[model samples]
Target: MHRRDFLTFSGLGVAGLMLPHARLVAAEELLAPADVARQKLLADTVLAAAHKAGASYCDVRIGRYLNQAIVTREDRVENVVNSESAGVGIRVIVNGAWGFAAAHRTTPEGLATAVGNAVAIARANSKIQSRPVQLAPQKGVGEVSWRTPLKRNAMAVPVKDKVELLLSVNAAAINAGADFINSQLFLVNEQKYFASSDGSWIDQDVHRIWLPFTATAIDKASGKFRTRAGLSAPMGMGYEFLDADPSGRYELPGGVVGYGRSYDPVADAIAAAKQAREKIKAPSVKPGKYDLVLDPSNLFLTIHENVGHPLELDRVLGYEANYAGTSFATLDKRESGFRWGSDIVNFFADKTQPGSLGAVGYDDEGVKTKQWDLVRDGILVNYMATRDEVHLLGEDASHGCSYADSWSSVQFQRMANVSLAPGRAPLTPHEMVKDVENGIYILGRGSYSIDQQRYNAQFGGQLYYQIKDGKIAGMVEDAAYQIRTPEFWNACSAICDERDFRLGGSFFDGKGQPSQVSAVSHGAATTRFNGINIINTARSLG
Candidate 1:
C-alpha cells in the first residue's frame, strides 16, 4: 500500500506515517524530569483559578509524555526517532455543564487564561444542557504515588542495543528463507500528576512496551504471497519483558510457538518465516460449522471486540456514536438481567491486574482502581463507568475507566482490562480436543469486522488447523468465523485452566468523535466453542 493509503486511517490524532511530528529531542534530554512538586504547584494554581472563575467543580492534569520508536526492514535500519511532549489539560463543571481547556505553557498566567476559558465554555454549554452534571461522591485521598515496577526502564535502554536487536530479528527471518520482513519497536512513558478541588493529589509513572514483527514469503512460480506475524503481546512492562522464559512455552499441534509473559523475538521470527511459506501451499477451508478450539492469543481479540467494547457505559448511552456507532448492549438489557454467555462463561473488567495496560493506582479522574464483574454465570452484571457517568448507572462509585492518551486531551470513558476467567474444572486444550469429533484450531489475531453496534461480526486468524476425529489433521487457509454476539458466547463448551491463561492487547484502540487511541488488554485461556459458522475468504461472488 502507498503512504496515501495508510494516511486514510483517521483513527489516530497524532501519528507519523514514517516519522512522528513530535519534537525530536536528544537521548539525554528525555531524562529531564518534570518534577512532581512543580507539577503539583501548577495543578494547585489551575484548580484555584477555575474555582475563582465560578466553577462548581474542577480537576487539572499536568503531563510529560515520551516515546521512542525504531523501525527496521530486512537487514538494515529504516528509522530511529525519539520524541517528547508536555502540556496541561483542565476540566471544569459550571452551572450544570462541562467544559475543558488545555495549554502547552505551564506558567501561572497561562493556567489562569486556560481556566477562565474552561469555566466560560462550561457556562455557555449549560444553556442547551439536557441535565445538570452530577458526579458520584468521592472522598479525597491526599497525596499518593505509583509506578510500574521495572527491572530496567525501556526508555533507558541504549538505542544501539535496540537497533542491534531489530537487525538480528530480521536476519533470523531472511536466513530462514523469507522473501521480506519488517520489524519495529515502540516504548512509551507517561509522567503525570492530577489535582482536584476535592483535595486529592496523585502522581504516577507509567511504562509500556510493544515489539511487532512480520515476515513475508512469495512463491514466484505460482504467483502466491503469504505472511505471518510474530505471536508477541504488547505489554505493560519494562525492557526485561523481552527476556524469554525457557519454561514459559506452549507446543501447539502444528508446531507453532505460543509465548507467555517472557518473549523470544528471534525464535518467533524463525518460526514465523517457516509458517509464512507453509501458508502458500495450505488448503482453502470448507465453509461449514465445526467445533472450534481458540488459543489465548486468538481468544483475547475475540473477547476484546465481542465483549469488552459493547459493555462500556458511554457506548451503551450513545454518548460515543461517531466512532464505532452505538452499542447493542443497552441499559434496558442490564435491568432485565440478560444472559450474556453460558453457565460457565465469566467476563469481568479490571484495572488493578498487574502488568495490564489499564492497571493504574488511580484513574485520570482520581478514583482508586479495582476489579468488577461484567458478567457472572452468563448474565450481564454491570457496565464500565467514570466518575460523572456513575450517577446515571444507578451506582455511587466509578469504575476507574477514565483516561486520555495525551496531556492535551480531556479524560473520558475508556475500556479496562476486560478478561475471561479460567474454567473452574481442570481442563487442557489437549484434553478438551480429545472430546471433539470435528473442529478447527486457530492461533494469532487476524482481520476482523463487526457492526457499528458491536454485534453480528466476522473474525479471522493467522493460522488454522483441521481437527479430525479428535486429532490435528492439516493446515487450512482463508478461514473466517461469523457470530451473533450472544449466540457465540452461549456456545461455550470448555476453557483451559489458569496455567493456559495469557493476555493479548492493542496499542491503538480508537474511540470518540475526535478519535483518541488507548491501550487495553484482554485475557483468556484456550477456549472451545461448538457449532459455529465458517466462510472461505478466498471465494468472491459476483
Candidate 2:
C-alpha cells in the first residue's frame, strides 16, 4: 500500500524496493493523547454493555494512526502523501466463543452498539462450538501509559524537510554513478488506548520510520543491469535516526560498514551506487560448498522466515495456516528438546529490547511484555504465544505477542522481535573472517524462498565476496545458498560478540488470512555457517 517509484529496476530478486503506503496523514491532524479518565469511562461503558449481554470477557482498543510518505526519483519529487485513521474495535467472549466488531464512531452509544453486535456474533458461533476458549491468566497492571522515548517526533518534522532529505539522497546515488535512483521516506505515529475487563486501562504512543531506496547501474553496450539497495535498517527511533553519530558506526571486514544507534542514508546510497556498478561486472559465482558469512542485514530475514515464523505456537498448533503456511517446529519437536542449532545458537523472543520495533509496555491483549527463549543452547525450548495459545504449551501467561495492524483489525498472535544471542567469546566478524580460507561473505537481504513448513530454503543477498587466503578476493554475482532449517542452524559454527550486534528488520511483514502487516526486528552479530550449498543462479537461469 506504500507509494514507490514507478521506474522498473530489477536484479534484487525477491527483496524488491519497499514502496510507500497509499494512506496519508497531515501532521497537525495527528491525535494528541486523550484524557485518561474519559477513555476509561468510554471503555467502562463498553465493558458494562458486554457483561450485561452475557459476555465472560471483553476488551476495547481505540487507535489513531498517522502516516506520511515522501518519494523521489533522480532529480524530481515523485509523490508526497499524509493521512490518518481512527477507530475503535471491541472484542468479547460470549457462550465460550469469541467475536469482534469495530466502528469509527467514538461515541458511547456507538461503542455500546458495537459491543452488542460482537456478543450477538459470538452467540451465533457458539451454536456449533467445539470447545470453550481457554486463556492464560493475566494480572493486568491498572491504568498506565507507555510512549516511545523519541527526542524529535517525526510528525513534527516538516514535509518539506522530508522531501529535501529524499531528494538529497537520490542526488548522492546519481552522483555516485547510478544510472537511476529511487528514494523514499516513510514515517508513522500511532496513538493507542486499550481497556479490558481484567481491570487494565493502558495507553501507548508509538513511532517508527524507514528511509529506503534502490540504486541501479546498467551496461548499455552489453544490455546488462544490476542494482543495490540502501543498507539502512528501518528503526524504531524518530528523525534522530537521520543524524549520524560517529560512535554509532562500525567498520566491518572488507571495508563493509554497519550502523548502530543511527543511520546515514546519503552515505548508504553512495555505497549502494558503487556496489551496483561493481555488480554489473562481478564474476559469476562458481557453484560449490563454501563457508557462508552472513551479515545481520541478510541474516535477519532468514531468521524471520525459518525461525520466527516456525516458532509461532499458533502456526505449530494448526490454529493458523494461512499466508506463509504452518510451522515445522511442532510441540512434539520442542518437548523432545530437538537440536535446532549449534551450542552457540540461542534465539529469544523479546518485546522489551530498547529501540526494537516490537518493544511495548504491554501487548494488545493487555499482557505485560517480557523476553523468553525459543531456543537455548541449540535446543528448542519454547514458542511465541498469546493469551489464548499459551495454555497449549502449559505456560501460565502469554508470551505477549498479540497484535493488530489497525484498530479495525482483530487482534491475534504475531511474531515478536526474535533474535539470536551473541557469542560469549569476544569474537569479531573481522577476526572470524581471517580464519576462513574459502567462503562467501554475504551482505544485505536478497531473493529468498522457503517451504510451507519453513524447512527447506534458499537465500540470496545484495553483495557476495569470495574469500581466499584469509582475505576478501572480489565481488561475485548470482550466488545463493540452500539449506534445511535444522541443518542450517546446526551448521552455525561461529557468531560474533555483542560489540558487532546490529538490528535488521522489515517494516511490513505480512501474515494471516486477512494478511495484516506487522513490523518486526531480528538482531545478530555476524555469523558463519559451514559447508552451505552455494549455487550459481545466473548459470542455472540461462
Candidate 3:
C-alpha cells in the first residue's frame, strides 16, 4: 500500500463529512479597523521627546494586532476566541546604556511618560555597566509603510462561518475512520510602526493564517492506537487562505506537483484522518542505519532546528543562554570554508521572499532587509545579526534580522526566512523516490529533541512509509531519525529539484527572556540523504 493508495482507499477523499457548522458566524463584528494615524503619531512623539531629553539615541515602536482562533474536538467545538491588543515601546540611550519601557496606551501624554521612563532607566543602568553600549552605524532612512496583499481581510469573515468550516472538517475526519479528531485554525493581523533617531520611519502590516489538524485512530478491540497531525504552511496572506473549498471557486491542485488552492476543509480533514487510521495498524519500525527521503513538510523542521535557531548570532554568541540554548556554531566558524553541510547543500537566510511569514520590509532597528547566505555550498557563511551585534563582529552593517515578539519587548536578533536552495536539475518527487531502492519517506513534523548546544537532534513525523524495491510498501509506526549536526548534513546525497520545494513554519516558536513567541518560515524541496540513524520510538519509550 503506497502512500497515495493508502489515502485513496481509506476514504480520506471525502469532501465534507465532518465539516463544522460554525462557518456561518459573522467575523467582522469582532474586529474594528485600528487607527493607523494614531499609531504613527505615538511613535513620532515619543522618539522626538526621547532625543530632546538628553538622549543620544532613541526609537519608538507601536504595534496593533488582532487574533482569532478556533479549535474543534471530534464532534464538539472546543474553543473559539477573538482578541485585540495594542501597545507602544520606547528605547533610549542615556549615558551610553540602553533602557526600554512600554505602555498599552498610545495617547500623547502616555507616550511622553513612557519615553521619560525609558531615559531614566537608561541613566540608571549606565551607572552599573562597565562598558558603554555601541551600535553599528546605519544611514538615515525616510518614512516607509508596507502591507501584505490579501484577497479578503480575515476580520471580515463571520465567526459563525469560521466555526462551521472547522466543524465540517471534524465531521469529515470522523467519516474517514478517525476515532477522534482535533482541529484548530488561527488567524492574525498585525500592524507595526517604528521611528528612530537615525531618521528612519517604517510602518508594516501583515496577516497570517494557519490550520492544524490532528486525528487519532484506535483499534477498539485491542486498545491499540495511532495519531497523525498536519499543519498548513503559514503565509502572510489573509482569509482567502481558508477559501480552499473544492466545490467553491477555488480548487485543490491535483497530482501534487503544482501548488494548488484548497477551499475544501473536508478534503484536508479526511486526508489527515485516513493517515491516522493506517498508522494504527502499521508495523513498528526497527532501528538501524538507512537511506531517508525527506518531504518538504518534514525537512522544514530540520532546517528550523539546525539552521534557523543556530544561525541567530545572539544564540551563537551565548546571548540566548537564559532562554533558548546557545549554538555550537559560533561567529568564528562563519568563515568561507567551514563545512556546515555537503558541497551540494546551499542555504540562505532571506527576509524578502514573497509570502514568507518572516518577511519584513524593515527590521525593528529600522534597517532595510536583505538576503544573505547562512550556508554556502555547505559551508558556514553567515549568522543572523542585529545592529548592535554587527559592531561586535566588526561588520559594517546588520543583516536586518532583529525582531521583537511584541511591542513591550526589546528587539533582538531573530531567525530569518531560512531556506535550502533546490537542485538545478528538475526532478519530480516521484522520480526522486524511484531512485531510492530501499528507504523511508517521511512526511510532516512531530515530536523533536535537540541537545542544549544544538549539536545532536532527533525528529519524528506524522507519516512514514517503507520503500522496498523502489516502491512504497505500507505505513510504519514509531519511527524517528537522529543525527549529529555535521554528520547529518554531510550525509546528504541528493536533493529534489526546485519544482518540488515547499514552505512550512510555526507561529509559536518560543524565544527571549520572559518568553516571547515569534513566527518564522523554512523552505526546502524533497531531499534524499545517504545512510542515517533511524530509531524505533516505541521501543525507546518502553
Among all candidates shown, the one with the greatest lDDT: 1
| Cα lDDT tens digits for candidate 2, 89-136 | 899999889999987787877887898899999999888999989989
Record all residue pairs in model 2 with backbone atoms less than 3 Å apart, i.e. clashing.
Answer: 1-21, 1-22, 2-20, 2-21, 3-20, 24-82, 24-83, 25-82, 25-83
Clashes of each: 0, 9, 35
lDDT of 1: 0.86
Candidate 2 — which residues are off by over 4 angstroms? 1-25
Per-residue error (Å), model 1, residue 366: 0.4
Predicted structure 2: lDDT:
0.85
lDDT (10s digit) by residue, model 1, range 310-410: 99989899887876788999999989999998998999899987787777899999999999999999999899999889888889988999999888888
lDDT, candidates in the order shown: 0.86, 0.85, 0.77
Error of 2 at 278 (Å): 0.8
- Which of the two candidates, 2 or 3, achieves a greater lDDT against the reference? 2
**lDDT by residue for model 3 over 1-542, one digit each (tens)?**
12332232123421111111112223563466556677666767887788789999998888765667776777777666665566887899999999999987767777888988999999999999899988888887887787777788877777788788888888888998888887777777777888888887788887777776778889899998888775457776777766764432211111121122333456766777777777778899978887898887788888998878888888888889877788889777875467988998988988888777888888889888999887888888778888888776678898898888777788877888999999888876677777877788888787898988888999988788887776777778899999898889988888878656678876667688776667788888888888888999999989
Quote the RMSD, in angstroms, for model 1.
2.5
Whole-model alpha-carbon lDDT for candidate 3: 0.77
RMSD of each: 2.5, 3.3, 6.6
